[model samples]
Target: MTTPAGSGSGFGSVSWWGLSPAVDLQAESPPVDPDLQADTEHGTPDLSVLLLGSTDGRHLLRTLARAALWPQRRFQFYVLENNLEAVARHMLIFSLALEDPEKMGLQEKSETFLEMWGNALLRPPVAAFVRAQADRLAHLVPEPDRLAEQLPWLNLGALKFRERDALEAVFRFWAGGEKGPEAFPMSRLWDSRLRHYLGSRYDARRGVSDWDLHMKLHDRGARVIHTREFRRWRDTGVAFELRDSSAYHVPNRTLASRSPPEPSWGAHCSARVLGGHRHGALCGLRHRSGRRKPPADQQRAASQATPLLSPETAGEITLHNVTEVFREITAWWRPRAAQGDPEQVRGDGDGSPEPAGPALESFTVHFLSLGSAQTLHHKSCYKGRFQLLYVACGMVHLLGPELGACVAPGGRLIVELAQYLVDLRQEQLQGFSTKVGELAQTAGFAPHPGAKPSETLARFYKAGDSGSGCMDLTVEPGTPPP
Candidate 1:
């Protein structure tokens, strides 16, 4: 379950989205949509950014929303990801996100995005839409001409053949022709996982979820998600914020962070602080073959119980869902649609209203397989190419020469903290931070000396010359470099 480290048995973590909220690069925090007209009136070069391991396109979507997605200026996002599922999921998100207002509407797009983004199951419409895109996505991979014809802005040719094929196979499964969607009982699986995750306090799963929502999530001060919405998501693996859709029980096994995990995995992802348990790396993320099932009552407990939170903490946090959080983000679609000739909608060459137009030509995302990209980064062309390098949390070991080579001199490096784990303590977070800072230093980057100790966002400037230092950082589980 070490999802961030980018290691596994050809599988993704159970969670499709990062537990931590999405972040924007400080260098481009408030992205001014190049405003091509404003640009033509003035002038601006394309905004180039390289994003490493953007879990499931949330960061990218957040960035796009900030950019206002209009002609403002050309945008190039070189998205690097190792997980094929994330790639397949990314394609789906782009499809859903780009649907014109006439077809999906702002609320529909935001709701659908959140559904497909996190839940293992989906509403009927979403499921049907996913199935419809299977053939098109499958075909789009093998034909660069079709890729260009359909998603003119998206570039997937850089991916390896095997990676592309794997992506195709993933879409085929999503098609639901071979095996029925019944194969994945997401609610049952969600309950089973909750039981396992809660360990001895399986009966207190509701209480735990509440504690995590209020005592943990709210304890951080404020969050975009409300307790009710968070509880629903935690319980069902589905978010029903602006939710007009039906039961999200359709089993989006695609979000499963991994293929069916093997039973023999005894490794722990990282240190977790369970209340009664000592601070240490936690394991047992996989279910062994022929494992006994929990009693029916216990299995039904999480489902039968209503949402709960500590009495004293009820008013401690806001009880609002993220409707407004994403409502305005989705608002970007209306203007794009209303502006004259109705937004152009291409369905990966299928004539469906999937990807938005005009902006497509200027807004391109280079889908790079992490492993393949790592190899590609070694080439001379990769030297000093990007103004910013974003390293996802728990993936610090990957900031070796290959990654370091891509940053332009004086370019910035942003390292994320493992802020997802609600129960993780300050010392544990600091431990993660100090380890990352040290790794960044070794990788030829240094953070500003003025960065506060407790700050989660770490901005690092490329140290010394462009090609000054290169070192391999291999951090073992539970043992970060001292």
Candidate 2:
């Protein structure tokens, strides 16, 4: 069944296929003329189109030519490319007959040349030719502000066309003083503009121009309108490829390549989009208030508040310092195994401890538990050395040389014993007393000892054996150790 047109101006009746049967162009012509005339008088042309082409030149040219033939209205087309001079001459000659179609013989020749050029520009092998045409047309039109106001939309990079004059204004504002095709930073044009305004860059290195352009516009506060109606002519001699050619592909991969990679398990962990009553309520309130709640409020209403994690805030966590903590932990663990068995302490080929090997350089740090279990296991062996065992969540565990046999999940290092168990639960087992004595004695043997017998014993009990046994610590100050 044919869909009935929604309520709007007569423009609503115009579909991808042009005006519907109910709205005859001949019958509607007189009424539309007044509106068109009024728009023209206001210095806004009835319609102006900016055709951006590099590879799909023929397709766009033919599309514009056919569109120009619309019986009821005339559209002024501005083709932007790198070389404005050549395209200006070509278009002038091509449209000479149409400019005065009453002339004999010239009509067929003009039409034939238009078709020939269109076919050449649309073909895959003629991408260079298409690009040349685009280069020639880029500088032909003057008064961009007039075009911006006159044209309802402008096409850039790929998605056909967009109605965001602010974007074009930004481009024109930046590409100042520079002239000719040489001045245009075709590849990085979108990237630089997006980065300048939105603090984000487009990755056009992968031949993903269209998606990048859309994202760039979106990043810069542009609201894209998704229409069901087709906007451009399909199968107009241009071949559409869902995947781009390797030659046009951008090099840098991964979203992080757009900027620095986010640190592993930092404060800025990625989250899934959640929608429901709780989200709706908080977001609704925030939207109405036009301000975000304070951090204290977030902490107080942790269950309702979304995680306050972002790249900007994550930088404050000092991930670089975490590396030092990891190294300390590795040193502590290796000695413990060595003391248990000297043969096992022997260094591997890479100078790491046997079995566990050298210290881990990198590993995935899980913030939350798998399920009812709250175990955090480091999967891959770090730096081809030590295989990290499950450690307690929240608490920072340090490693040192004089360690002994202890539970896998939690065992406080002598150096940072006091700070480690400050926010943990006390254990009720004989193992705590024995382990603490051993740890304290070992600490005393070190060149610079920090742990006391009393402190070690207190921390031992506080440290849990299994990850689940560990207490859920809070990010607060002044908590007593154990």
Candidate 3:
């Protein structure tokens, strides 16, 4: 069971992809495309950004206007608001014109929200927008069977807006990494949407695309930035967090807030609120089994639901089907994995192995946030066969071996959060990685002695990999278990 020298997953020799810790320090940066540079010089900067799920057209238009840092340096914009009616409403209020519908057998456009607002007509721009709609209707040149192909004029130019049903196409555009027609970012900076916002600090560019700066201080306020891969996953099946503004039944916070002094477990899970407003850390749970059926209402509204991160598995899953998954992962999934059943090795679907379950109460799971690993290590419940899983969580202080020491003889340990946070927060990259094998070794575990170095993505620290037995679970932290 002894791992060979430079092979015990100790960030051994460096690799070309820089995936390994022992990666060549002399590795060069990814090459920038020469054509992209030429395009930048020639007026258009090959960069095209798509604003996804924009509720209104106002932000979309304003962001595009700001992103034009130079007079002629306009970036191409693709918008898909995920709501067809909202898109129509925005077009009506923004002085846009859609082709007449009589030729297409569709009913005439009804009175829009802006039209209903009597005061809106008093504004010069609003009155102009209404007048344009009347002109388009009176001067009907509607062509039959051309609604899908016809352009909707916004400010005299055709706007590239798609339907909500085109979610797949929108996601494909994001997921595509420098490939095919949607591969518009010709620059090597990063293959994701460029969020534009006005800067607050002096000397900082009036318009900025950096995520942290814009998301924190931009005039539009804090916005969450998702990786291209995360977006693709969300579009496919994952549900967005329940607290997301896009969720189906948005909870009225004033009525739903958890009474204060919060849960004792809140100490374990610390969320960083951006604007000094206290928002509880969102806990999304999904059953690895994927056997649980969704409720009748959720099933009907599934297509419109926003996606969320699935804690138990890597990809996206349902968010509304929460009542049960929470109970199952802590009570069912982890405990079953701790048992080491060969049948349970293959997840119910997808064919990939699921992480060994991290035990919590059969019903309630305490927070598994920033410093959760250390918190779990100190808790009595994590004593024997219990495992620890840190999903796309923040980078906090805790070593690998400190956690590896807690694994029982038949249990497993998986840590994606630490490596992810380091790569994302420190390296300023879209993905995550544990520094070579430093995380695993420090966690007091090693790659399975028999596994090849290429299998670094999922290094299962099997039971007995370290001779260290479970530590005394009696030493409790000052805050006793609820």
Candidate 4:
């Protein structure tokens, strides 16, 4: 098989202890179209395998290669090493073991070797287990009932997979449909409890390197096959740490030392090390599937409109916005109710307390712009039974009988328009354009002389008012009031 040129190389200058740099053999090259014609005349192998590794990875690679159905398949190896020294060591050992059968005692030394690097595989499985347990536990709890109760503290513990079937179910779910002794070797089997334990410590923010990549590939609809039948090597080596540490650690070292020597290999290796190619591939896949990035203009508009509120400002604004509307509506209701002359009410013989007066119980605040067709609606329910309607807008007309209240932009109205409509259900209010002279004659409402009425008004009545009515003034399609 012809290997890509820059397949394996160490990341520049940074000494990562012994970890290998990531390998990317196809960085600059476009993804191979699955439909592309193959050169069958050359008699290429049936399968193409890309083996990425370093010094420690030699044993794993040899085991895999030996177990693999080769000759019928083409195997392409890419070894990435941190330094020349490590690469040389891996090459010498691998070549000797492959060429001289008598010099290879890998099977005898397998247990001790694995013990040195076992955590590399064990940690990830443990984390997956923990997460599954947490999810199961959460599913068991009754959400609504818990929410309804006013509990100061609630502790829901871990889940228990009591049956072998339960464990098998999880394994199958993750491993997918292809399952058998050959497909999944017992060596790859991990303790089921590891899932639960590791899941508990899983941090999405920190991210899972291998799983994240796997998910990215899966999301792109890539066909991934898992062979569980491979020989299991016990891990006993130093744990690989990818965060806040040198990249020359366990896995990196292993990857670097085993990469192929080719220019394309280096480029591919660089891209993989930087995570650029994978990310780009995922994005490209998403784009090809009709998922697109927002247009620049839309993005700019969104960024411009995103309200930047400081913590203190946000809190104050929220509190004040709600409280101001509440207080204003309450003020409007208090006087309006007192106008009913409560003192004149005849008390019951044993008046313990007169049944509660109809005070402002709740209110719905609507913020609207007359010039712009944007409206923000907020509903606030009060303890009392009565309801108030608060309208904050640039300009509005409260269609009332003979008494129309016009509010300028940024003004508020607290009258219950719905109640007014109910009261005037039968009344037919005449439609009249707001004339400049007539508007000036109104006591509380005045219109700008230069401003023209876009449309004639249609009137209705207020609730509980026998003769009181209201008028709805709408703008014409072509004409907008100034």
- What lDDT does each candidate get? 0.54, 0.24, 0.27, 0.24
lDDT of 4 by residue, 436-459 (tens): 223323423333222222212111
Query: Candidate 2, residues 215-313: lDDT per residue as tens digits?
Result: 432232222211110011011111111123232322110011011242221222122011111111100110111011235543355434545533112
Tell me which of candidates 2 and 3 scores higher on TM-score: 3
Worst 10 residues of 1 by lDDT: 281-290
Error of 2 at 376 (Å): 73
TM-score of each: 0.70, 0.18, 0.26, 0.18
How many collisions between residues are there in candidate 4? 74
CA shift at 323, candidate 1, in angstroms?
Answer: 7.4
Q: Model 4: which ten-residue window has the lowest total lDDT?
A: 225-234
Candidate 3 residue-wise lDDT, 162-263, digit = tens: 222222222222222123322221111111101111113213322221332233212221122233323322122122322222322211110111112433
- Number of clashing pairs, model 3? 19
Task: Flag regions of model 1 displaced more than 4 Å.
Answer: 1-15, 23-44, 68-72, 223-227, 241-246, 257-358, 449-455, 463-482
TM-score of 1: 0.70
lDDT of 4 at 473: 30
Error in Å for residue 2 of model 3 = 43
In terms of TM-score, the best-performing candidate is 1
Positional deviation of residue 343's Cα in model 4 after best superposition, in angstroms: 99
